[model samples]
Target: MRINADFTQRVAVHFDQTEWVASPAAGVERKMLDRIGDEVARATTIVRFAPGSAFAAHTHDGGEEYLVLDGVFQDETGDFPVGSYVRNPPTSSHTPSASQGATILVKLHQFAPNDRTTVRRSINGADYVPLFKDDHETVEMRSWPSGQVVPIDAHGGAEVFVIDGGFTEQGEEFARWDWLRLPPGTRTELRAGPDGARVWMKSGHLSGMV
Candidate 1:
């Protein structure tokens, strides 16, 4: 039942190294990440839908976030191709399906209450702004040329997952599905080699724990 289930510790694992398990629904499966409860557990995962498959309607009581990995994802709202980043905040609901099938990175029941930021950005559409700084911290997405300058402010933690790249952070190499977490007030940098880089990152959840 546990693949990469290390909630109380800092850990990392490559995606392909983990096995996928069946869900209650047909044509759907998941590579487990983290879980705290049984059926209603808060978790992160890589979910896949087989061709012409669909899932029943569901409510995101604790919220849901996903990045389309391959093919296309579908719902009553519309279709999402690869590179789509989606956020369905708390209390949001939707029915998801796909015709040609798809794979996605999904995070469930993990969002700040009332955090309403919802978006889908094409990773290639915008340029990566290195040395990006704000009053709170400096933020930057990955780029094609590789090596990146990372900045961290204070009172926060971060998780690193390579969506697509040969990424290395703090000298630790990470291939797809490789995951890592840094404690609060910790800082790290990343780089990608010949293939460029894409990642799924979440932060600002440290505070007094730092």
Candidate 2:
């Protein structure tokens, strides 16, 4: 069960641009971008939980990383409101639910073994540090103004989420909630639209594998 499972190709799946499909969980709905499993897979997705909805507890064999795009997300641990960044590294477990509805950009089964742990960050308190002129790194979350180019650094590509506002690159337009996976060694430049987009971006993990 492989859906865009290969890391050698450039893949982009838009959430707003693509329709969603139902999940095995009663109140949970998912739109899979790239996959490699059963009803659940090694994919990137937009998952929505209906009010008071929840999934049974389970182990994440390959880890889970996600960002709260809208509403409030909760589990036994705590509640993550919009603009939260989370990382549940390899061999972690949880039963996630949302009582007030929620939307998330989630990447599954992607993590370095040494990275095992759980992370919860309030992105609103994060700061953007300059990696280089015209290129910056946000250890947190924030906006990238229109026409601002941030190269993905050709040596190792990147993954991106259009969380708020919209972004365009190489003639591709990504609206809110869109997910993109650019393979290692691919150069990318993002230009925000009139909305002056804010995106959650990550890179350098494609090389991590079982």
Q: Give the poorly placed runs of model 2, Cα more than 4 Å off.
A: 125-142, 208-210
Clash pairs detected, candidate 2: 3-35, 52-99
TM-scores for all predictions? 0.81, 0.86
- In the range 22-128, model 1's lDDT, one tens digit per residue, is 88889999887766666666787889999988888988888787878898998877899987777787888888998999999887877666655555555546545
All candidates: CA RMSD (Å): 3.8, 4.1
Give the per-residue lDDT digits (tens) of candidate 2, residues 1-210.
677778888888876567778787888898888788885567778899999888899887777888888899998789999877787878788899999999888888765556655677766644342211113112235577766766666445567777678888888988887777777777767778887877777766564421
lDDT of each: 0.69, 0.74
TM-score of model 1 relative to the true fold?
0.81
Worst 10 residues of 1 by lDDT: 129-138
C-alpha lDDT of candidate 1 relative to the true structure: 0.69
Candidate 1 residue pairs in clash (backbone atoms < 3 Å): 15-177
